[model samples]
Target: MSSSPSSTPWSTPCGTPPLAGGPGGADALRPLVATVLDALHDGAAARGGPLPPGGPEAVTAHVRDALADVLPDTGTGAEEALHALVTALAYGAADPAHPHCAAHLHTPPLALAVAADLAASALNPSLDSWDQAPAASALEQLVTRALATEIHPTGPAPDALVTTGGTESNHLALLLAREHHGPTLQTVCGANAHHSIRRAAWLLGLPEPVTVPAPDGTIDLTALAAVLTDLRGPLLVTATAGTTDTGSIDPLSEIADLCDTHGSAFHVDAAYGGPLLFSATRRHLLTGLDRAHTVTLDLHKLGWQPVAAGLLAVPDTTMLDALAHTAPYLNPDDDTRAGLPDLLGRSPRTSRRPDILKVAVTFRALGRTGLGHLVDRVCDTAQQLADLVDKNPHLDLYERPTLTTVLFRPTDATDEAVAATRRDLLTHGHAVLGRAHADGHLWFKATLLNPHTTPTDLDTLIALVEGSTTR
Candidate 1:
C-alpha cells in the first residue's frame, strides 16, 4: 500500500520568508525539501511493487484529488498540499526498475547519475553561450570529444552535441544531409528506419524518403543498392543500426560500400544499438559505424541514464557548419577571433540543459568496461526471455535479441486476445509489457533493462501472461 494520509510526513512548516539577498536559500526550502524526500522514500517503499493497479484513470484521479483546490487558493500552508501532490506522482506512475517491468527502452537510473542530475538541475546552466555556462561549454566540448573517440577510436574524432534524443539527433543529421545536397535530392532508407527520418525530410521540405525493402527487420542490400543505382540526384542514404520493431542491425559495411559507390552521404541511426559498441564480442556487429558520415546515439535507451540524453556525431566537424549562424550577441566575430570557446553552433536549442553532466558522471562512475557489463547483462536477460519464448508451445520469438528487446506473442491466441492480455496485466498490477503490431500481426515486446530480474521472476510473468489467455 502507498503512504497513508495519517502517515504523511508533512509536519514541516511552509511559506517561510526568503533570506536577505539570497532568495530562497537552503533554510527557506528546508521544510518542503525534507518533506518531499520523505515522501519519495515512503513511496518507493510501498508494500506491493512499484506500479499500482487501475492504470491511467487511477493515477489521474490521484493527481486531481490532490490538487483539486489549486485553482482557487494559494494562501494555505503548502506543506500538506505539496506533499500530497509529490507523493501521488511517485506511487501513481509505473516503475521501470521493477523486475517484471519490461516494456520499453526505459532503464532504471543509477544512483550516481540521479545525484548528478539533481546537482545539474540546481545549477541550471544553459549550454548555448559560453558566458551563460562557461564551465559547461568547455566541459561539454571535452566530453563530446571524448565520446567521439569511443565511436571511431582509430579515425579523427567526430564533433558531438547533447541533443533531446534520437529524434533530434536524427533530425539534425538529415538536416545536414539535406543542406549538403541542393533541392534536388533523394534519401535512401530502409522501410524500418525510424519515423523521425521521414519527419526530418518533411521538416526540411525535401521530397518523400525513398525507402528500401526490409521484410526481415533489416535492410536488404540488393534492394538498397538498386535504389541507389536508380537515384540520379544527390543521395542521402540512412541506415538502421537497431530497428525499432525488431532489433536487427543492418550490414553497415555492405551499406557503407554502396554509399561510397553512389557517392552519397551516409547516416546511421544507432539510437538503440550504439551501446553495443561497448560489448567486446558484439562490437563487430557495428563495424562500419566509423564509416558513416553521421551517427545518432541515445544514452537514455541503453546508457542507464535518465531521459533526454541523446547525442549526434559527425566524423567531420564541417558537417555541423550547416546549422551555424553568426549571432553577434552569442557568438560574436570578436569572441570567435579571441581565445574564448563558443558552443553555440552545435545544436538547435538556444538554451539547452547540460544533460551531458549526468552522462559524464555516469561514464566516470562506470568506466567503459563496467558500462559494457551492464549492456551484456540486459542483452543476456533478453536472450533468456527469447529462450523462454522458443521453449513455450504458445509463444513465438519474433527474431533473435540483437540488443535487449524480445518480441513474442501467443501462437494459440488471436490479436485481440494478445492485446487483452497486455491490458489485463496493467489493470491487475501484474507487469507493463509492451504491445505492438508489425508485419500485420500483434506482438508482446519485452525490453530488458533491470539486471536484478531473475529467471523465476520471468517465469511468473510468463505464467501471468498464460493466465491472461483465458480472460
Candidate 2:
C-alpha cells in the first residue's frame, strides 16, 4: 500500500477522495446541507397529497429530464452540486412523516436524531478504533448499555453493537449463534418469522432453516417440541417479538421453556416491535425477552432514528467473543478491550459509520417517557384504524392491531377490485397503503407510526377508498 498521507484516506477505500474539502473546501458544505434539508421538507409536503401514474420507464424518463443539469459532467462547486443531487432524488418519494404513510413499519426519525445524522456525516467519524473516534466510541458504549438495561434487565448486562438495519441485525444474531453452536447448527423459527433469518442461515454456511408452521401467525409449541425431539445437534430457535405482515408476536415465554428443555440457543427478532419495551401497557407481550440469548432491535423502525441503526444485543458479553478477530494495526491487544467495544467485532461490518451518534442524540432528546408516549400513540392509532375498518359497512378487518400494523380489505370487493383500488390510490395520490395476500384473499394494509395522524384522517382515507372502488 502507498504510504503517502494523501494516498490513503481514513475510513474510505484508497483512491476515493474524501468528502470534507476535496475540491470545494469546508465552507461549501453548510449551504449544501441547509438546501438539502429544505428540499426534503418541501418534497415531503407535496407527496402527502396524491401520486401520479407511471411505470418504471416513465419515472426514469421524467427523472432524467428534470435532473439533466443536476448530475455533473465535471463536478460543480461542492455545495451547489450536493444540493442539486439530493433535491432531484427527493422529488416524488413517500414521506414517512405524512399521516397517510401507513404502509410499512418505517417511521419518521426524531428531529434531533436527524440533525445529529448531518453532523456525524460532516465529521465522518469511524468506529473501528478509538484513535479514529474517541468520544464517538464512548457514546456508542453508553447507548449500548442503555439498550441492554432496557431489554435484558435482570440478565447479565448485555453487550450490543449497531449494524445497518434489521436485516443485518438478524444476520449478526445468527452468525454469533453459529459461532457459539458450531457449524452443525440447526435453527428453528415460525413460518411467519422475518425472511432475514433464512437468508442469514444460508449466509452462515448452514443448511436451510427448519421452519415451524404458524397458522394463527404464531409458533405452534407442540410442533416445535416435535422438531426438538428429533433433532440432535446444536440448535438456535428464533422467537419473533413482532412479525412483519400482521404485527403478530410469538409466544416468547413458551419458546424460552422449549429452548431450556432442549438446550438450544434462543434468539428473539424484535426489530419491528422491540420498542414496546418502553410502553407499560404493551411490555407484557415481550415478557420472556430477558431469557433470550440474543435479541435484535431496529432503531430506525420504532426507535425513531434514521436508517442503518439496527442493533444486535447478546445477554452476556462473553457470547460476543464468537465474532472477535484481531488485526495488529487495527486493534492492538492492550488497546482492544479498553472499556470500549470495537464495533467491528460484534457486527458484520468493518470500518463502520458512526451510527451511535444518532441513537445517543435520540435517546437524550426524547428520553424514555417521550419515546413511550410515541409508541403508545402509534399503537392507539393502529387500533383506531382497525376499529374504523370494522365499523365500515363496505370494509372487512382481517387481523387485529398488535403494535402499529392493521390488515383489512373491502368486504364487497373482489381481488381484482381490491388490486385496482390499491393501484388507483397510489396513482391518484389520495393515500398510500400496502397490499398483501393472506388466507386466499388480498388484504389492504396500513401501518400507523406517525402520531400526528387523527381519526379524521383515517375517515377521509376510507371515504377515498370507497369512492375509488365505486368509480
Best by TM-score: 1
**Residues 1-471, candidate 2, lDDT per residue (tens digit)?**
223222233222323444654454344454445667877665555444634236345557656865676545554443444445555456566667767767788788778898888778877778877787787888888888788878888767677878888888889888888877788899898998899999999988987899998888889999999998898899999989888888899999999999999999999999999999988788898999989988999989888888878888877778888777777777777675565445557555668788989988877877888888999999999899889998888899987888888888888679999999888887766777888767878888888888888899889888888899899
What TM-score does candidate 1 reach? 0.92
Alpha-carbon TM-score of each model against the true structure: 0.92, 0.90
lDDT of 2: 0.79
List model 1 lDDT by residue over 42-105, tens digit each.
6656526647787788767877886777656444345666677777777776788887888877
RMSD in angstroms between candidate 2 and the native structure over all alpha carbons: 5.7
User: Which residue runs of candidate 2 sit more than 4 Å off their true CA positions?
Assistant: 1-28, 45-55, 69-80, 337-343
